[model samples]
Target: MQEPIRQSYEAAKELYAQHGIDVDQVLRELEKLKISVHCWQGDDVRGFLFQDQALTGGISVTGNYPGAARTPNELRSDLEKAFSLIPGKHKVNLHAIYADTEEKPELDELEPRHFQRWVDWARERGLGLDFNPTCFSHEMSKDGLTLSHPDPAVRRFWIDHCKASRRIGAYFGEQLGQTCVTNVWVPDGYKDTPADRMAPRKRLKASLDEVFAEKLDPSHHLDAVESKLFGLGSEAYTVGSHEFYMGYAIQNHKMICLDAGHFHPTEVISNKLSSLALYTSGILLHVSRPMRWDSDHVVVMDDELLDIGRELVRSRLLDTTHIGLDFFDASINRVAAWVIGTRNTIKALLRAMLEPVEALKKAELDGDFTTRLALTEEFKSYPFGAVWDYYCDKSGVPVRENWLAEVKTYEQNVLLKRGSRASIVN
Candidate 1:
């Protein structure tokens, strides 16, 4: 998937090297011309247990990773006690400890008072609070029962959780002019063995049926199941569009939210899943950029967009909101690194944005998305224009050949006084 593009870039690199082109200057120009992708999601550490991987260093992943992520005071005050500067905005999407885990030790082992404040807390800061009620095969679930688990008692437990979750989501929506979306990813597939779900499938269907039948409301939310592969030789059929399209086939209002990286690992340009999702009358997409190497390191949409944008636009599945920074920084200095990586990624995307919309129009007549044409590096880099060229073109500005030399001199003489990684990250 990344091979062809990397190869093309390599060829260009060689051509420039042969011509003795100044790479550093070229890179700086590229960096200066970019835009931030979303600039939200804090894309760093302190948000998740893991380090922000895009930065210096990161923690490694292990199976069944766990954390009881506490937010006794929004993790803000506690964080202030640890660091000199504030991290990015403290955002929450449902794992708020004070909200759900607050102890009451009363009915169902907790009182309603314990669960009541998340609505206001989330509203005050304007974070879209979200969570999945159907627990996976972990200690969190009653006997590890997902929606599909058979024991009626366990099923009842699952139902109760969804009911409560829906209410919480809805309360916020009703009060805040928003909607709480429940992202349901049924982790009910089999392990590496002969698989049969004749009985379990029935239970699974019943579980979702109960969800739509009894657990939904105007404020409550439900998105489609998370798309994933099946184990061993079996194909995942839980919501296979052809066979079950449980979320899409039916016309009930629930929509499909495609994780950018959830589709095929080997990048094949199909219509953008979001576009396809929109065609299925779904919107409210989850926006993490895709990577041919890993799903989680969501960095650039242009990389993904170039591969699938035209079809995605053609599919017209939905419009994009702020592209979600669905990545985890598994590295040191998780915060600043997230910002830097985002800056780099956005720069790359802005480079693409610099591309004229006219290209798409020409491509429409051409019938092929990838008909090759000679594109100058400046055109590719400065969707706006060549760094100096743009200033000249739009603002009637001019640059001398010694411009780089002059800028470097001033930056060192003055700007270099600015100190520390803290300035960069914070």
Candidate 2:
């Protein structure tokens, strides 16, 4: 396998050299780009703190796949298995609800001490950490309104949670020596037509003002706000619409998160990157797959994913853009979901980096649309899979579908045992 990989890589290198695409340099750049793998996927968004509570606020996990991580250790172990199959070191994204603490603490009362275990794990593995405030699934959010809730106390509780989340995020950065992005996303909206929308927007604006009032150091922590078009219940009105957050983030000098599935089906975040880059200091991307809507399906190497990669590479937004995966699929092996989604994401970015961007730009500048389109289409069928295989082999990870064998072996030995234990307990 090594010999075949080396031979294919050499041939592919020569082919890419003819088109002015350096495959070696592209791999190096890809190594520098880290994708923050979300932790919720391992347990289907059922965080540690609120396991007894029903998942609410327009969020639902459809499948009951075996071997869902039931403890922090189990989740970390699953992550370790998934990471072994992946090629590079990456960060883990966590929500406030996933805190590990013996004492029951409210979301507003969360602290850095609660997440020290996660910090230790990340530090040991040479990985970074990112955070988010859980603004749903609690009693306060039972009515589907949080930051913009009419009750001042309800809004205050969420505001405090966000504030505490920032401190924890800053703590992660300080401990790990890597900047942590703390993103805020609230599931606050109405299912039916609202008679008064301005009031909620005004309240939300004021609440956010309080959340961002205490400015933290930029070196250790960066703040970002994510907006959604609509959710299962919030189909009629979403308090934090795209335009609202766009204006707020630009005004507040905060990074804006552009979720791939948070807009109209026809709309793509690739096209919005250039526009947002001009205003926002930095951008946080939540890359996910949407089946007609925001389904949070495991990401695939599809056309839109490729387009996103191309835009990021061509626009030179790698330095300012933070890429993170946001999807949970319980229908398949949980660990396999992480491996598949993450590998496809890296492959998409790798394919984009392997493109001859200068040639395409030159063709476009010279008004040669035909050459531009022709080269774009021609590059699609290049020996991308061969280069990807070589990268996997070089990184000491399994090449191609060979990783699946290890996952299957793990399922039989580790995952199946978990299911049997659960059945006996039940």
Model 1 C-alpha lDDT per residue in residues 137-207, reported as the tens digit of each score: 23334322356676787666665555555555556556555555555554444433325546666676677
- Where does candidate 2 stray beyond 4 Å? 419-426
Instruction: Score residue 339 of candidate 1 by CA lDDT.
Output: 41
lDDT values, one for every candidate: 0.40, 0.93
1-426: candidate 2 lDDT, tens digit per residue: 589899999999999999988899889988888999999999889888878788887888888778888778888999999999999989999999899878799999999999999999999999999999999889999579999999999999999999999999999999999999999999999999999999999999999999999989899999999999999899999999999999999999999999999999999999999999988899999999988889999999999899899999999998999999999998999899999999999999999999999999999999999999999999989999999999999998999999999999999888877853244324
Error of 2 at 403 (Å): 0.5
Cα RMSDs, all models = 12.1, 1.5
lDDT of 2: 0.93
Best by TM-score: 2
Candidate whose lDDT is highest: 2
